[model samples]
Target: MNTSIPLAASDAAATSPTTLIYWFRNDLRLDDNPGLLKACQKANNLLLVYCHDVAAWQMTRWEVPRTSRHRQQFLASTLADLAMQLKSHDSRLLEVEGPPAELLPALARAIGATTIYCEEIAAPEEQEEVAALRAAGLTVETVWQSSLLDPTDLPFALDDLPDVFTSFRTTVERHHVLPPPPLARPQKIPALPPAYAALVEKWGATKGAISSGFADAEPIEHQASNSVTYRTGGRSSFPYFLPLFSGGASAASEHLHQYFDRKLAHTYKLTRNGITGVDYSTKFSPWLASGAMSARQSYAVLKEFEAAHGANDSTYWIWFELLWRDYFRLLHLKYGPQLYRAQGLTSLPQPSHDARAFDAWCQARTGESFVDAGMAELSITGYVSNRLRQVVASYLIHDMGCDWRAGAAWFEAQLIDYDVYSNQGNWLYIAGRGTDPRNGRRFNIQKQAHDYDPDGAYRRLWSAQ
Candidate 1:
């Protein structure tokens, strides 16, 4: 989340102050926020709110937890960090437990604010939330801030986005496309209105503050990771139990600097595919997934590192991986609700979902060693390696003959870094759907295990349970 570029104050700063509501969605940090920054510039007294969607905590169609306890624990850290930042600026974030459309309108009326501003999410359910908000007769403004490259800067229209990733990459590279510089955090924030207290009392809206005692605090050493029914064995690749790998902008920025200072980018391509430990990968996804880190901030720092040292193929590979992330997001903008369909933009018939087989896969009761081991690690740690993700996903769809959507739902439930776009896009690609012109992937599990887990280290690491 570190940015090297100099930041300028907004030209459209502080227009006729009005009471407004700024809803915090995926983009949590204030450091590089376009939506929150705009809210600050226009508001005299702003009500900051975040809603814990009931649906997020409920069961999915696949009969798995939509979001796991561990995922919520990590989110609690991020929310705590956000609250501390707001507190520094003499503001408070109201944590409500309900859907946005239901809670926000009442909260907006309570605060006497007619408009709600937030980040735009391109997924189906999120879009429905926004549409529902508009139907309630409120002005809701959404900013597109998640992507590194601005969609307006693209050489081609979204409707014409290349079907293949290679074509998309070459087109952008050919145009020498670059993301806009990261913005500075707002130095001065508007004060809360006198009505805020009455509003909170009248509506009884702010139920509880999860950020109460954990803001920027050190996590206990050797403490058990708070997960579902079971605790990790302390061999997690992405260890959320420790403070270093904990969720927040501070940790994310520190981790980013540590990765670059140690010059890991120079050998990233070589180590990226390794399926063990935190050192094998950049491990930036969790922060990025939660919006504690911005892709542009990471890119800006990468450019600085390249300037300080010399550029190489390894450094370029980092950018390559980032583009892959962007491509999946753009796919959402292009296909929208179709991406959520079972066939996923293909002429193929609906996928056959073996519920019993899927249950075994989810419980790690599947006899396949590599796949089960990977599933076990995910269940325990709320994370798994990118290589193993591909291997296990393929094993479920191609080998076990289970539905790809079922695997995606399980990932949605477990992954602390569960990204909707990437999860759906990758699942579609593996299932011979989505935008893959060559039609889906079918990774050979035996070959993958032999190639990556040559000495059976990864499998043995999670073999016992």
Candidate 2:
């Protein structure tokens, strides 16, 4: 539950003073970001900041770090590029090290910022951070910007959203509800206060500076040209990951252009279930997960593609997938913390957790060839194809009889494209604890391997690894 009270836009405009802080969370890009534009419009002296929380690196109860080295490297690349983008607009992302509730309030007080603007995240941990900021007496304004369709535009309230995806999709389509076009990136951003850099200097002098691996104690300079080089900094077992898809708005935009420019979307439905190679899918999840690309931005581009190439099942299916992502987000809002519980939305008996079985599955020694291949692929690379994700998750819950939460946690830790709402929702769905009309998703592993990888090439390739 989010405890922060909503602040009206007019109130924000009326009461805003000189200094403003725009805290970037999941929405890392400049374009199509309403909160960022509001920050730019409201601030006379703007300070842009992003906090890298230490909690993200800590180990979970499942004995895995909450985030992976590959994901961190991708994030580092994204932030480096985002910092450069901000620099292009006379601002820089003051890459701070600490909890946002701690660092943001201190920085806001130091710079005398009256308002803090950010994207609203509905997840439990993220919600607590926002609540903490409000409790600290910051005038925090948040926009519900993650979904393709705005909550206000929905035909029904979020609490009334249908449990099943099909019903939700039908209602939304019947209402003719659509997402508005994305906002453009600002041409120029407000300059940081000259005295603002002195806070870090003061902190360094007092030995109170937070040790963010990405932050430097030097004054954050806002330059005309971006000087930072984009590199996936940390070591990763998934060498095949980042090169295939880099982070930040630049890469996302370029990929969108090339994907539609080549008319690849026409065959999306045909190859979306494929288990190997890049051309099998659009591969936009990584960018979408990090907020480097907005859903509305993707939808707008998708509409343009439809206009130029004519609407087809493939294009419609692309929209369907986006809607599914939106449905998970809405479901999170409707269910709140129930979405994270072991029982989920159902009254099903809690599944027993076996740490030893989970360990074997995680290490790819399950001896189930297809499951092993999928797990091995995920273990070696921080990514798995959608078909493989379903297969692996089903095997974990149904075949191995392990708890779904452990599998969900592993996915959270490992995937470069982990979105909390979607990951947890999908896990619960597979475990029969969530929005499933039938008995939930249980794939026949051997049959799946035969149908998708008859040649056994994918199994052979990943099993060797």
Which candidate number has the best lDDT?
1
Every model's TM-score: 0.92, 0.89
Q: How does each model score on lDDT?
A: 0.85, 0.81
| Candidate 2: stretches off by over 4 Å | 1-17, 200-244
Model 2: per-residue lDDT, tens digit, 253-294? 988889899888999999999877767788888889999999
Which candidate leads the pack in TM-score?
Answer: 1
| lDDT score, candidate 2, position 150 | 91
lDDT of 1 by residue, 270-355 (tens): 99998878888899999999999999999999999999998999899999989999999999999899998888899889888789
Q: Candidate 1: where are CA atoms >4 Å away? A: 1-17, 199-231
Q: Could you tell me the lDDT of residue 320 within candidate 2?
A: 98
